[model samples]
Target: MTELMRTTSATLSRLWTGSARHLTDDELTAVATGETVAQRTLAHLDQCQRCASSLVHAADAIDLLQEEASASFDKAYTTERHQAQRRRIGRRLATLVGTESPGKVIHFPFSGRPLPQLSARSGHWIAVASAASLVIGVSAGQLLHFHAAPAKPISSDGVAVTESAQTVPLTFDMTGTVKLPLLGDGLQHPAGEWSSLTLEEFDELMGNPAFFGNDDLALTNFLMSEFGSIDALTPHVSDLPVNIQ
Candidate 1:
């Protein structure tokens, strides 16, 4: 312990300029097994409270492991077991020194190969196409507006008046040809006296009066020929034959 303190003081005297660093596994192992180590390791162990605490913890854990191992094994195998454990610990310490931590390598966009650029000719063509499309759209809009139907005039009541409400006098000439007239609102100027005639008078006018004369005999014959007999139509009780039994 006195020699350890002297070595530690000598290390501190040599490297007392800056902050002390943490001890590596090899340095810690050397300290634990009483092997010669760098003076800086000893100096750091003396100055750094965290490293000193870690060394103490490691020593306690090793002692606990040895105690547990001795309890499981016989006294005859004690020396061999201790030697083997030390050898294993040394090999592990050496591996820890040689091993390096993996690092992350990030690759950002545009960090490697350059991006392909658009050519001047392609850009000019794209602009020309865009301008043509704009002009075509404008012309189409104007053409649609020109072809649209005009709006009907609106009245004072906020309703659209498609045609005039007042009636228009319609006239047609039928000087040389015959014209048939009808009653009611449609014809204001009737050509013939057909509207003034009653239904009976119209029927009389349309009938062939010269062929079937105005006398009642001709009418009776016509009626009898069309219908069966006047007796059957009139159904007089006097015409019925009496059966006197």
Candidate 2:
């Protein structure tokens, strides 16, 4: 009997110093299930002031007992509250863990169309072709403008000469044609004549004696004033005849 009392006292002392202050959820469950570890722990707790105080706060009306009883009213009430709380938490955890979505399939609404789709390579080729056509059209217009001549000739010997100048009809093959009533005259020159001048020729002409002064300083200042900066002039210089390199 003395040994039993000493063993029970030592166990209670250990519980009071160790896990009694803050019992884990597992420990509380173990206590609910009447496990030997939990029973021994409770026996120690009954004798311990700190465990007894904590127990009062944990379950106010439940009678602390060293031996198991068959469904005591206080114990049943305490167990029911704890089990309800655990079940609520368990249900929440299950809802969180069980939520999963199905895989999705994406559909394009306007995949099929009359317009041809262009790849990167096709786009690049188109840009190159457009640039080439622009260059060619400009070159042809400039050629016509620089070579334009008067219909009649005035000779040095003061002779009246009847000369008919040969004219080549300009024809453009385009996707669509719209004839403007005012501009539909057959003798009108095609547009974009000055567009044929290369970057080098443009720069040289801009700096020529006929335009700005032929001095480098005057040309640089004029270009900077017109274009905002010297860097802006570099791209146009490459288009000029003298600065093609």
Candidate 3:
């Protein structure tokens, strides 16, 4: 016989003797091919009482075991599907109830609405610039107001009055011999040597032009007799003096 025929016969014999552990449906079908080797093996088994009885028993046992396992798996699958359906229905009911209640509506600020108000509002940079401009305008206005106004002039009435010009003279008594400028003469004199001066001489030596009106030399001689030395008559000629020469 061929090797395939030998192998098929050996496998069929093992199944009949119950020595074969198990055979998948494909293996069993392959051994049951409508070939002469499989037909001969079946004919042999039917004639032999022991092998035929064992084959019948094995087939019955395998069918019963497969039927039991299939029923159990179907029951478990049905139970799991029912449980999943119940959970899904419960979640749907919860969602419906929450939507029907008076709950606060939560919307994403940037996603849901058109944001008309925010879009109309000024941006941060624009707001800052506006505030800065307002401050700058106010500061500029204050500076302009301060600078536009004129300053008040000082009054000359107090110093320009002729009556207020009369004043006491200042004299420095030198301890040692010192040469001093003469009152009427155009030269200096020795210290402690008195030289009487008039108001004109006092004004000329003091560099005040308002003293001698027209003839400064004539006024100098007249002022020399009226006043003492140049230093003594200096105080009498001022904007405002309490004492006179």
lDDT of 1 at 40: 64
Please, what are the lDDT tens digits per residue for candidate 1 over residues 5-110? Answer: 9999977865574345567788788887768977767777888898889789888888999998888776567788889999778777776887643344688976
Candidate 2 vs candidate 3: the TM-score winner is 2
Top-scoring candidate (TM-score)? 1
CA lDDT, every model vs. true structure: 0.57, 0.50, 0.52
lDDT of 2 at 41: 60
TM-score of 3: 0.21
Which ranges in model 1 have alpha carbons more than 4 Å from their true place?
Answer: 1-33, 37-60, 63-117, 164-245
Report residue 239 deviation for candidate 3 (angstroms): 99
Ranking by TM-score: 1, 2, 3
Clashing pairs in 1: none
Kindly list the per-residue Cα lDDT of model 3 for residues 124-148, writing each as its tens digit: 7679899999999999999998999
Best by lDDT: 1
Candidate 3 Cα RMSD after full superposition onto the native fold (Å): 23.1
TM-score of 2: 0.25
Of 1 and 2, the candidate ranking higher by lDDT: 1
